[model samples]
Target: MECPCCSGKPYEQCCEPLLAGRAAAASPEALMRSRYTAFATSNFDYVWDTTDPKYRDEFSHAANCDWMSSSLFTGLQVLAASDNGKEGTVEFIARFRRGPNPEARHHERSRFRMRKGRWLFCEGDVISG
Candidate 1:
């Protein structure tokens, strides 16, 4: 299956390894893409695990899973991305639908950092919805 991150690559070659714990994301944008894939595939634990420990408690697993379960993730568009080796940012719009609701765009700029040789999501600023 094509990756939901719109990478135009097979799932296995794209985000699967990241989500499966077989490999780590090579860059911040790659981590962002894989996180979107995790949401799309209901791999909520992966999302939680990949989050920075200091900020992980800021999110509730139940809430995150509930949102993921209720929404049908359709696609992801990375608008801008930058990396400075240790810290990075990715701005993106994730498209999704819930029940009979119209498709919605979740626009955000997410921050990530490299810790212990693995990329971890730090936080995000919601740009629009």
Candidate 2:
């Protein structure tokens, strides 16, 4: 099936490998896109694993899982991305519905860093809801 990140690629060819530990994301945008897929698929472990540990002080597997479970993701749109194979930023919109609530769009500019040869999501600035 098509990727939820709207990368114009199939899920396996796009985000699965990155989220499954089979390969590293090529850039910040790639990592961000894969993360959107992880949320769309409810791959809580992948979402938690790809997050930078420094920003995860309040993070725990159970809490992350609960957070992912609270929403049903529908789509993703990468608005912009700039990477130098080291530190970079990505702007994107993720659409989802919380429980039985109406769908909403999450817009953010996310930061990423290359650590241990892998791109990890560091943090994000929420732009809109």
Candidate 3:
């Protein structure tokens, strides 16, 4: 499958290791990249798997899948990433095109949790439109 991060690489060559339970992301930025790829490919299982269990039930996989299908993520630009070994944060701009509109950007600050040596998505705070 195509890379969900819009990196112009196949998923296997890009983020598959993280999604397949073979490896954990080394940083919150890497986790966010993999998460974006998961969303693009409609890999709900990976999305759920990479999320902290505390927040997993809050994710509506079907809705996410539908939204992903309807929007095309054109690019990702990571602005900053910081990890203090256990917890981390990533700030990024995701550019997407929905329908016939021009690309729109989502600036987000994402929180990450490291549990049992794996990095999980905790949540995100939208910093700007």
**Which is the leading candidate under lDDT?**
1
Q: What is the lDDT of candidate 2?
A: 0.87
lDDT of 2 at 109: 96
Once fitted onto the true fold, the runs of candidate 1 whose alpha carbons sit more than 4 angstroms away are none
lDDT tens readout by residue for model 3, 6-44: 667788877988888788888888889998877766677
| Candidate models: Cα lDDT each | 0.94, 0.87, 0.85
Model 2 residue pairs with clashes: none
Return the TM-score for candidate 1, rounded to 2 decimals. 0.97
Name the lDDT of candidate 1.
Answer: 0.94
Each prediction's TM-score versus the true structure = 0.97, 0.91, 0.87
Task: Between candidates 1 and 2, name the one with more favorable lDDT.
Answer: 1
lDDT of 1 by residue, 13-104 (tens): 99998988899999999999999999998888899999999998899889888899999998899999999999999999999999999999
Candidate 2 lDDT tens digits, 1-129:
888889999988998888778898898988899889888878977877888999877567787677688988888888899988789999988889888889899999999999998899999999954
RMSD of each: 0.9, 1.6, 2.2
| Winning candidate number (TM-score) | 1
Q: Is candidate 2 or candidate 3 better by TM-score?
A: 2
Error of 1 at 78 (Å): 0.2
